[model samples]
Target: MTTQLITPTQSAYAYPLLIKHLLNTPLIYSPDQEIVYRDCFRYDYKTLGKRIKQLASMLKAQGVKPGDTIAVMDWDSHRYLECFFAVPMMGAVLHTVNIRLTSEQLIYTINHAEDDIILVNEEFLPLLESVKDRFETVKKVIVLSDKGAIPASSIEFSGEYEALVSDAVPEYTFPDFDENTMATTFYTTGTTGLPKGVFFSHRQIVLHTYGVMAGLTAYKSQANISSADVYMPMTPMFHVHAWGMPYLMTLLGAKQVYPGRYEPETLLKLIVGEQVTYSHCVPTIMNMLITSPSIKDVDLKGWKVIIGGSALSKGLCKEALGHGINLFTGYGMSETCPILTLSNLKPHMLEWGEDEQVEIRCKTGLPIPEVQLEVVDVEGNPVAHDGQTPGEVVTRTPWLTQGYVKSGEQSEELWKDGWLHTGDIGVIDQEGYLRITDRLKDVIKTGGEWISSLELEDIISQHEAVNEVAVVGITDEKWGERPMAMVVLKEEFQGKISEKDIQEFCMTFVEKGQIPKYGVPGKIVLDAVIPKTSVGKISKKDIRGTYGENLN
Candidate 1:
């Protein structure tokens, strides 16, 4: 078929879709929409544009060049937003360092990414100083202080962040580059080993942004985001670009509020003060907000939040809805540009009752546009979309990561048969919605039955006394593995609720056919809190390691 080839005329020109181009429409249209950083400062999109250019100028002045990696460790702030644009726009890769990682893993990610320089928030200076000697590529340290003057540090400062931007020329041009140029890189919070690096190109990010916008708006969604939407990111910016909401908001020129740090009181204040209309986070944050005394008297009506990074429990969903907050589920991971599915209701489905709506909204969701998703058996055959046939969810999308950086074996495993294996076991409904049952490793195979730990967690979290829950499979001789639950009780319910009560609760679900009898955990260990991964998902692997041994 290629034997006859023809070239296009010179009249045709190709325009690459780089990250810098995302700022063009906003600068032209909504130049005055404010980007607020808590109560500390506020700037319009015009100034955001200017600051981004200045930031680029400053980085260039500091020896950053195309393809160099500039890392940032800070809270979700205006400065982070500027770097989100400026660093990538200048053709230098942005490495959003995860402060939640341990000192060792933190050093590993920075070294693996080959970051040439790091911009550290004052609070993290001690972390930098502890590992600066072990850094493989770091050459400069720039301090970022939101408060008063930064204290003296053992590690010498290359330049203060604010000063660098202030001193630089604001007129530096961002040259266009190939759309496939690597734009940003970050490490995934893996369970079994050190973090894995995943990166995206300029074209992938832009497409993901538009795809998310389309997915949110293409249906009847209370959480639909647009220019009128006031945006706040509850997810950490260091994690999957805060599910990439920052770029979508900027592209739409929406009013943005960056809560410097996530405190319950501070978040409530900003939600009320800024009228934050839309946000996204894991279920833990939702639990915190709903239970916090600060939000008790606050009217959270009209606040739409998309829950991801973990499953949304029905109890949590009902609680958020009771407060008149529009809550739903979104499904993605650090690998798929962090978003491939969102559980927005169809137009006809909107008339369904609230219970049905919550049920639908909590599923893994339908795939967004340009995303090809499938539930496949071990042999790579497609499963029947009957809502009961469980299989691994594999997908093909333009925005998915090329592969794990420098890990060829894992990368090959990720893209076997030309589809990106998600390592997620799920079932697709006849209506085309995906319900993720469990991670491939987290599923309990007991007495020749597969039990979903997420299912158990969801069922137990409905108890009035339960605050949070995690279910993990513990090793056993008779059964290959048995489920054990670690629970966190509400303060008032502590020491009052017994393990038997939870067991009896599970019995009720078994009776109702919600879960099988074997799916119930043999024990429920009550605690003050459940440990979480760096990105806020419940750390089931840690729980298994702690309790799964010597359970005789």
Candidate 2:
């Protein structure tokens, strides 16, 4: 006898109902509080959302269709936040261009995405102007600035951002868009090669938002969060949607504080005065904040932080715990709707001691609900749950990007058998916790075994003298490839340490065989500070590009 498969009644049409029902709910809430933008102006969210809707109305009037892509270039600000919602909710795709990218790469992404209009901040206008002629698809330019006049050189836009919104009706209706309609497009950071685009639909973003709120994921509760909680995202808006916190904050109805350009002092002051209860940034940014001279005088007792965009160092995690701040680590990528796993404590782990709990919280974490994650070998076989054997991490989620935009190479490898290969080497514990051991490309192969550069970096960063560190493989004739440590020492101990000290420390972790003789970095390059990506992880790509070729 053949068995019949049954589908749940709610599974067939749950998305549209949720979207339409939640439309008029209090999606955004900001208290009557002051948010100092660059130590200057202050604005509330009621005003912010009004401006957002006005901008949405303006975009609608300008012939922006549902599928059109509107690219934005600006620092973190109320206006930037406005574009985050207005463009997407209006059914136009918001393409946040990475301002730190090279001019050529910037031109390449813009032309490739075919952005219909470019909304640029005044400070970035000159950079845009340098490649203005190269953007063949952009028909209009909307300047976002306090300056009164549009520059004479460029063609007149419909109007300046503020004026255009002021003239438009704020009450314009947001169209009923299908959940599957394109909502936003962001290009990958592309550590190795050209940037590729990833687009998210309304359904994906909405589901991602819900997944973020679930207690098993980030465990963000509106009850725990209030209108009083001030949010300052240290991550830039241009990178991986700032890990999607801006939208999440809006959805949670929290008061958001925007730091236009990240200055450690500015951020610290906002946290103290604004009583910032929650924030999100990468490990490097957290390092900068805690180590900065300004932090000594600041009171950060109630601050809760979420660390992502890269691995969180044990050193940084310890420092955060010391400050009486609640810190949690998560993992994701630009292709995975930016959040796949978050380190929330499991039910059984709650009985463990505080120290034991922190260790688990430091891992990459369990896959968020609706996301399925696996550690697979070279042939895609699932690795054991013993947590000792390492394998390539792969996943499937509703929010993950279908594939890179306009790129054909390795597309098959990226989404083979309907799962996204993360290229991260990791293992899953019996408790289902995932700990990323290394990036597949960055893993050191010596004596026919894999060495995790991430593991070594985490250990080296624990030294009091080390400020930041990155480990990359240097080609070796004998071992094929060996690990090299590029370090940035704490300011006070710059010349006081040697490469031998770092090597000696690694020897204590394991025997010579367990930690390969060649696994220790052959050379250590000392720098004033390690270069970092926009989201604040140490940029090993930059280090390898600068120094790897020199190694034999």
Candidate 3:
């Protein structure tokens, strides 16, 4: 059979899948819905639409043009949400700058991105001032402030965010362009070298919004979100478009509460005050919320959170469940538009109890709509779906970035053999659920046996005394490499729990045949806290650097 492509008539409108079109439904159906930014501001979707245009108008008046890179440095806020739409809708690339990056990394990303303008928050002005001198391409700065008064800064400001937006016309003609035009760019928080840039097109972002939306709401699951659900983002807006939820939520016109800075108390208050039903975050933020004193007063019932950026440990899952929180694991990286799979329960499995559900939710999960995934062996052959044999995960999806921006060598390596190679090792069950074992680089090879660092962390985290834990491989004289456990005890157990206590806890799982005896670390170091990546995943790279040596 021959493939036939149809051409549209001259009078027919060839609608491009642009970000501006996402506002269509919301503008008509949900114009009255509210969008809140901390305690300082609140506006309906009607105002949101106007403000989006106003922002675009302001940017244009300041010499911003199509294809220019506009970087934003701010906490998750309504202003950031406005930029998410207006900048890209205007045909300029939106660079969601990672505010948590180191000074050098920050400079590298801004300069490497060749950002033409920066919309920086009042709080980040000093940081921006320190690095602005080194920026090679930035031509202007616009300051964002909650108080509506721009803070005093050393750098020259084009204008204050609110004042400029208020002054600009509320209507601007956003030109139609090719759907494949670049819409967004961001740097991954890599541990080894400088941060690498990943970019996406308008088509990819729009399709990802649809794909993730269908996967989350089309099924019967505890983690499902809907138009009625109140939305908030615990994840930083700078990171993979906040896992692209802000776009999805805006399209649904869900009432969104933006917690400007993620203070534990403030986040808890917003949840209680605004009744935020759907949110997403890393496990570290989950732990922070569960341990917060304010959490005791907040009713988390009906609240749904998607845990990403790291493995969702069983301990964290159970803890969240105990607090009446519906939490599930989501899998993806910075390069895959940050959403590949969701651990939403299958309708039949919805009848299962909390314990059974936790197991499924902790898995990397079934691939989302349109996401093609496989666990492949070293030679790139698909591995058995027995849930025991592990292999590197590879995937193809409409939303996956074509390549890392400007890094052709790494881009070629990432898309080797036509499938984007995810460096994490994972396993698939007979039912098609993927369970990530560990990063390929983090797997501990000791005495000719491979051990999963993630498995060890999951086991150790189950201990009652363990507040947070990370497992990394330490170099050994005889074994070549061995697992080393780093633990932080609960506040009350700080003095009572010893390093030996954690080893014995792992032994319990060892005896149960859940893990091999060799998996138990010989060296267990109790500490006050474990270091984390900018995105809040356990920084095994940093941990290995500090304690990877064989002291004995």
Error of 2 at 98 (Å): 0.8
- Compare the candidates by lDDT and give the number of the best one: 3
lDDT by residue (351-458, candidate 2, tens digit) is 777578678768998787888999999899998989898899999888888777877666776898777999999999988889999988788887687888988888
Evaluation by lDDT, superior candidate among 2 and 3: 3
Clashes of 3: 0
TM-score of each: 0.98, 0.91, 0.98
Better of 1 and 2 by TM-score: 1
Best by TM-score: 3
User: Model 1: runs farther than 4 Å from truth?
Assistant: 1-6
Candidate 1 per-residue lDDT, tens place, 377-493, comes to 999999999999999999998899989999999999999999999999999999899999999989999889989999998999889888889998998887878899998888899
For model 2, name the residue pairs that clash. none
In the range 1-552, model 3's lDDT, one tens digit per residue, is 899899889899888889999999998989999999999999999999999999999999999999999999999999999999999999999999999887888999999999999999999887888888898999999999888887777899998999999999998999999999999999996767888999999999999999999999888777778899999999999999999999999999899999999999999999989999999999999999998888888899999999999999998899999999999999999999989999978888999988888899999999989999999988999989999888999999999999988999999999999999999999999989999998888999998999999999998888987878888999999888889988888788888988788888889998999888988898988874688888788888888889867935
Number of backbone collisions per candidate: 0, 0, 0
The 10 consecutive residues of candidate 1 with the worst lDDT sum are 217-226
lDDT of each: 0.90, 0.77, 0.92
